[model samples]
Target chain A: MGRVVVEVMPKPEILDPQGKAVVGALPRLGFTQFTSVRQGKRFELEVDGPVTPEVLAAAEEAAVKVLSNPVIEDVVRVADIEADAAATITSEGLA
Target chain B: MGRVVVEVMPKPEILDPQGKAVVGALPRLGFTQFTSVRQGKRFELEVDGPVTPEVLAAAEEAAVKVLSNPVIEDVVRVADIEADAAATITSEGLA
Candidate 1:
């Protein structure tokens, strides 16, 4: 199987309260070197076969339609992963 | 300045309702090749300098403490981006 990774992030004009909270909490936690923090969403979809152009297109459509709210958010990145090799086991599982 | 990207995902043992909803919606949307979907969080932190090892460590700590609930989620990946180069402009901005 192949895997498609889609990243969804809020538009720059939108206010991200969760991200703002994290940014606000940082200084209280004693780390104050950051200028800004933007939080978003990531979706990992495992397909039934090797990733192809058609799959990517379909995934993109799904990501735009189902994964994010286009009014306030956008799809930032879409990546293909080889399930047979790099995806069967979690990287943390190895550790 | 530099940037750090942190990806936070639910632990394998934890339940992901948002992911489940997406998986359920895909078939209705005419795309049904996925076995599963896992939704997660991504944080893009813009720092004021180059991303050093210390910066990565601090970002990791913040990701763990402020960004995710360690009881149910985990940090999957931590990436460093160069602010002076590719990070200066959005890839979509060129379009």
Candidate 2:
């Protein structure tokens, strides 16, 4: 099985009420270091076969067309889960 | 300024109606490669100063205590955005 991860975030200009609420609540919860918060969406899409480049391309297309509202949100990241794991491992080695 | 990214996902055993709906809709939208879909949450927390270890630690704590509900969600990742960018750059080099 292969999985792709897609992340979508609201446009910076848009007002994010949920984020505002979170930032407001954090201070009360004693996590005062945070100055702002922006809530977004993450999606994991699974396929039966390996995540080929074609699959990733399709996932990216779908991420923009279906998963997010273009007017208000931006597709921030789209990556293969296995590839991401490999990247993390390589990065850890470098670190 | 600094930022931390936190990702939360539904527990494996939990029923995800939104995911189900997405999976059902994918075929209709001509995205037939996907077999399953799971939706989750992503949060970006900003701070006035650089993202220190203490800030990242606080973000992790907040992710568990406030960003996600223990009953149904899991805090999958919490990382400083700048660090993540560095990791990505290193990973790309290896790739």
Please provide, for model 1 over B1-95, each residue's C-alpha lDDT reduced to its tens digit, 9 standing for 90 to 100. 87888888899899999899889999998988888999999899989877877887899888888888999998877667443123223322321
Tens digits of lDDT, candidate 1, A1-95: 87887888899999999889888989999879888999999888988877777887888899888888999999977667443213223322322
User: Candidate 2: which stretches are off by over 4 Å?
Assistant: A88-95, B89-95
TM-score of chain A of each: 0.82, 0.90
Report, for every candidate in turn, its global Cα lDDT versus the true structure: 0.78, 0.88
lDDT assessment of candidate 2: 0.88
Residue range B48-79, candidate 2, lDDT tens digits: 98888788789989999999999999998787
State residue A44's C-alpha deviation in candidate 2, in Å: 0.3
Question: For candidate 2, what's the RMSD?
Answer: 2.1
State iRMS for model 2. Answer: 2.5
